[model samples]
Target: MEKLYNKYEVYNRWLQDSDGYWQEFIEKTAGYIYWAKKPEKIFEWNPPNPFKWFVGGYTNAGYSAVDYKLGRFGDKTAYIYINPEASVERRITYGELYQLVCRISAALRAFGVKKGDTILVYMPNSIEAVAVLLAAARIGAVSSTVFAGFSPKAVADRIELVEPKIIFTQDYSLRRGRRIALKENIDEALKLSTWRPQAVVVKRALGEEKEPPMERGRDMWLEEFLEMGKHGNCTPEFVESNEPLFVLPTSGTTAKPKPVVHVHGGYQVWIVHGALLVYGLSSDDVIFNTSDIGWIVGQSYIVFAPTIMGTTSILFDGAIDYPKPDLFWEIIEKYKPTLIWTSPTAARMLMRLGVSHARRHDLSSVKRVVTAGEVLNPEVWRWLYEEAFQKNVPVIDHWWQTELGGPAIGYYYALVKDMPVGLEFMEIKPGSAGVPLPGVEVEVVDERGNAVSAGQKGTLVLKRPFPGMTPTLWKDHKRYMAEYWERYEGKLVYYTGDAAYIDDEGYVWFGGRADEVIKIAGHRIGTIEVESALLTHPAVAEAAVVGVPDPIRGEAIAAFVVLKPSWRPTEELRKELIEHVRKTFGPIAVFAGLEFVNMLPKTRSGKIMRRVLKRLWTGEPIGDISTIEDEASVEEIREAISRLKVVKVSE
Candidate 1:
């Protein structure tokens, strides 16, 4: 079961016959779902359009996630909703959820929703929120779910994209026991939007959750909407496989938002494959993902992937460390999930609180841990794999982007057991993303689109199209071409906008964004290298690095570090950290200054916003703070940088 070389040979064959490889998925999917019409062809290679799969075929993505599992997993628990802030746990079966999807889709169609229409889901992590997505995809309508933590303006920015015919939202969202007025935000967002939707459906709270006053004709209560659509047609729409399933906005530090569109056939094909191949999902396993429906992970892993595979997904609705620092462990002891998918930021958050509270609860239930949303630093991976799980489970680190519908590069955790002899001997690199996924051709290329030598840092580009890879941006085909495909002179190569290097063993190591690399003296350094090195230090709980203009070295590294709760920031500790980086990261890493802060700026999806740090360091105006997870972190980091106007270096 460990033939690593044999697996490589299998992967090479898959690359040789890419379309035939996806045909295998088509055959497997056909057994579960009833396709309205069989596809005339398996695929068509054309860019600047949706990734074509099952060309000329008709199927509904939602049907695969819900309908197909009805007979087989009808009474089985499809989802478990756990909200610690509200102190609630609710399990919904396929039959019960099927009814909701029927009623909701009926309601949507009754309220003038139809094929090709777009709707916005501005709600928290709950069964109803995910149901709305399923219902939308069940029909031909496209649904876009926004993060609950986004501001009114941020929501409005996405609202302006499709001018959704209907917005599915909630009365309020509970976060760390704090009430966020979601309905009020939607009302304000509608005013900012130019297109007027026919109706806004609001799902109220549970237990003492009185229905809020509606805006007359503009808003409809969830119960009332369900009643209205009760008699409407609930039959799944016969949508072409290549039709747009949903649109997810890019929430990075970009100057403007580019909503990425995912189609029915290609999206489902890869999400289902990745959930099984990448994460090893099955009906016997329970996956607890600490992500929200606002991002791609939430849509694919939390909602689509598990249900499509007839597995139970633990839907976490509130903060990971909220109510108590040991909330994650409490859930683990209670539910005994087989797999845990989370972010490096969340893991570091728990790691910062120390293990005293975690040790009190049993963590033996987890079989594997997977991390993304930034490179999983070796320090965090080792802690989770060794100290937390006692090295009983593998802490896997995979890489992907929102533009990619599913995982592009990941180790085959689910299929690894069946791998041939040499495969088990393939040692896991704690820091590197395993390898290019099936039928995905990845290479580190220089500026001119030529492959670079192994271990040499360069741009990461996909030489050809993969099923799950985004065909184009939501409505801006020209901009999509300019942003991703045009960077390499419009040669059809997908520019990942990431700086990475593939080792001789074929593992991908992502340093950071291409724009985030720092030039010191005559050497270039990725900020991730400095941050990862800092994380290895005992006192450093979380660290973020950015390059600032330096008179002496062109660019120098400035680090913002958050020490563990037991450790306090001091001049002596700061000097020691500088020396530690000098020794570990080598003297090539020229330090401009190191600032101790209580927190680091991050997006709602848990990605550190290093650009904000660079802006704050130079006394420049930080742009577009809408997606900031914690606003206080920005101000705190800003104040710390004000005292660091004079660069201190060379310990």
Candidate 2:
């Protein structure tokens, strides 16, 4: 275990020493550029030196992704699109995808969008959405995508922040076998906005005027718009690597959502290097990530990463369990993609559907897979490895955040060739965040400002900047610094808001959030310890552990669990689960109560929104819940809690 990275001691040493860090940074970035594509200028430094990039780059993203492979691999397929209802699919060639992107870039320009202008795109996982994002980059216009499943309020809140002049949306979208009125929601958000965008709506499901437009510049048909730019050429714009390319939003503990800005220069640099290592990507690889372009994973993997590497990317418009539980398997069979990146929540659901769903189709084409967004429970990992893929394919349990643009910690397929069975051998300890990326530095410290030793837990902090880390929260620099930097100011460490520990081997394991740590009788207990123990029960499907205020103990443990189908909760079962926890980690990790539920409140990206639940339990006025992915679940949970009415157990 003696620090797996010590082999590259020279590189790590230079990364820490600031006087020499810039020299090493340039070398690493330059090396990546040369590997990705030999451009006219590898980098350029402008006056004020605010932005740095692949400098005077004479390379087109489209050419790198599509045009370069045209004559040589014109017949190589890029996307294998599957229609959920029809139970059929169509293969799109690399040349064909390139053409669509060019035409769409032309279409966007014909619609009056210009360079440096922002365009709001709200769509699901369709090929057209991917095309539009590339098209925006091709024309130098920034594309701001809103997650299609978000409420109108959520959509409008983002729109109001950026104030884009054009909004791209679809008439309807299909997901999990239901046709959602996407354009209708757009219409509602538009009504609330004082700024009017030239709205272009794709005819996805064949319904018109269901939601009437009340004003001018409100709606234009998708087909008509495409026709307007039919013969136009897509001469890709050469932008500085540090130029702002996309704006993403993250939910705040306070009322509003925080907008995070990422630049094309830094984003491309990291995406190329990170994807290569994380996914073992190659020019011939076909990637299938079941995510929408609205989120970071979709922005990076589904659109940018594969395309930047000049590879094929599969886009699935609906849920993994749409027409059947086998939709993902069906897509893999048809596309033969080499890589599939997704979240564990969906994987767990797929696991519940049983391996029969996978066995029905051919997944032999898949070579590598990744899971992210939230922590992947160890149980899900075992199930995916042994039961689903027959213990053959490697499951990379990636850990990163929206603020950290790419997969900072996970199984590096390129680096770890002989992937280990359990989670530990992949350069990371069981619960640790794993060792920091090549140049990034991580340290765990305590309240009095001192580093904790091995086996002890402390606040997780970043010692240096990586190219992918967000430079600032959009329109809120002070808040951004205060949130991430101020807490450990003089030390130059970025407070991650996460609690973690480093093992003797240098593997980093993440304990839950620092705030989630419960204090009982002068001892601090990580909620993850209790939650993990709770999930060991046969009846428990999933669990969320939180710390609630208590008079005597200062704080106590609360558990919310979603049980297996048809399993009724009883005092007897509850006692059994409590005893199970005691047996696993002793009585110090006891739960206040085991509350049963059908689903946990989560963000659109599958992250549990625990603060909302805390507010609910404490009877705080919930305000502007646009970010809540499951509004109905909040009501259901409240009703269930009222019915239970168990008295608070004291120490």
Candidate 3:
């Protein structure tokens, strides 16, 4: 592949002359999106805290995503939805989507929803869920979507924070052929919450579960809600660029999850630019994003990015291995998507099924494959490349967080002008998230706020604000500053809370979360490095490492692994895995204990919750397991720990 832009030149310019580079980059990328009002200033930064982007602009994200594409591509398919059972598929066009959004917005207005009011959506990955989000955006209402998997208490916490005026939910959701009563959960949450919001329910699974009794005056069916909108006139509300667009709750190690707020003007600009530059999306492309609408990736890629670019987005409402291990490959053959993005967890899960499942289907239409949400270990990355993709596509690993809103570092195919239309256009670096995107400043720094040299691990920080960066926490500006800004007080930087290192080639290597870094004796080791080493062994399928208190060493490394189906939990295999890591990373990375388990505890977005593992190991109270996909896995780990014998170490 030929180089589009000189990586060194761009990095040097960003380090030395940021203002000039950012100005040019902004001016160039801003032309890609339609802005109702051009901003007088590209960006403005305040001391210690406040930051704004695209000042003095007026735009609505819903309009740019739906209405802007209707004239040119009214009949073009905007979204393709597959039902939970995979028995039915539906295609929706831009014109149809626009009308649905407008009608829903009008209905929300009739139910007392207005500009600046918040609306909560609690539904599965269905067409109604997408419409509710767009409807809220159309009326300038802040949409807060809680993952349908959350418990009543988890949903109630977020509902209390926003106190939304109206809530949208479904009667039931289907998962792996099991029916989940979503309406019952919503009712339980409403009982816990003090505010009584109007509810609109969708009949997702008509016969699976009995319909919960609805409140006489507080609830209505989705069909009746649309009928209410038909009698009223509704129009898209164009607000200031910095108005709140949505509030997404991100889980931490603490008991209370933090709600991150993103706005219209800057978020829209960043999503559109990301779709073009990072994903290389065009009108002819169809993107299959294997994420739920509740997560940040689903909201950005599945809804906002592709819609703004006038491309087709795919939404699958079932597990990847529900019917069979090759269900995802079946989707690729049916939709012929040009791009596929999903979490590393899914890749590892599919790896356990072996390559035969994927080989049964043809994946000729997939041009690019990407993974996020967690570190893409070299083991799974190579398997996906050689076995799943047959070395024909680019397996790109990007890095971002829920707070960042979008990818900050990755291979950008559209970085330079006049590039080819294949995987060769983008460079792939194994085990590294590619260079920073244009106009984004990322640096690895030590605790003293000084930049670190190559191969040295430290905290990753963004030196300047980007268009998509979150302005503040929802109604908690002080906490936002305390968490993100206080660490770099004198310097104007945003702490990313991730530990990483920049290689000599300017690529970023994610170590792990700063809080999850395991320190043994005086040596600091990232759990990801140890976990990745274990994954290299043929027997290990998925692994998670945590630091546990030791009588001699300050802390010792404890590993929990899920083995492939062919391998069984035996003392010999455990010792061999420990030796593998010791040989790969030297004795400093040797595990004090290893337990073979069925699965690792992970969030709904597919991020391994190492904190839960550490808490479970040290006999501490597990804070929140609401976002966990399978709660049974936590108990499996507990039983495995009791059976495994610890490796004694000399002081």
On residues 1-651, what C-alpha lDDT tens digit does candidate 3 reach at each position? Answer: 013335434445555565565456556654345567777776787755568887888888888888888888889888899974747688889999988888998988887789999999988787778988988888899999987876676688789988899889988877777777888888999998998898989986554457778999988899998998787757888888899999997654333567889999888877765666677777778898888888888888887878877888887887887876688888888789999998776887788888988898889999889888666778778999999999998888888877778888887655435221123355677788787876677788887888889889899899777888998989988888877774454676788877899877678898656666564532345577677768878888899988776432336788899989999988788778887766543344545588878899999999998878887877879887999999999998877666644543221
For 1-651, candidate 2 gives per-residue lDDT tens digits of: 246655534335535563344333435444223223333343343322232444434333434455555665677777666667645456678778888888888887877777778888898777777777778877778778887876675678788878887788887766555667878788888777777788887775443436434345567877777898987666777665555677787554333556777766556666765676567777678888876677888888887777665677766766677777687787788778888887766776787788897888888888877877555667777777777788677777766766778877655467322221112235322323455555457788886658899878887787766667777766676777766663354555677766678778676777545655554422345565566667778899887767665433334567778899968888778777777766543334545556778898877887676766666766776555688798987886676555534654322
- lDDT of each residue in 543-571, candidate 1, tens digit only: 99887865434467889999999999888
Please provide TM-scores, in order, for all candidate models, with all chains considered together. 0.79, 0.73, 0.79
Angstrom error at residue 283, model 3:
1.5
Candidate 1, number of clashes: 11
Instruction: Give me the candidate number with maximum lDDT.
Output: 1
Ranking by TM-score: 1, 3, 2
lDDT of 2: 0.67
- Residue 412, model 2, lDDT: 47
Model 3 spans with C-alpha error above 4 angstroms: 1-5, 8-32, 84-86, 415-426, 487-489, 516-651
Clashes of 3: 0
Candidate 1: where is the Cα deviation over 4 Å?
1-7, 29-34, 46-51, 198-213, 252-254, 416-425, 487-490, 515-651
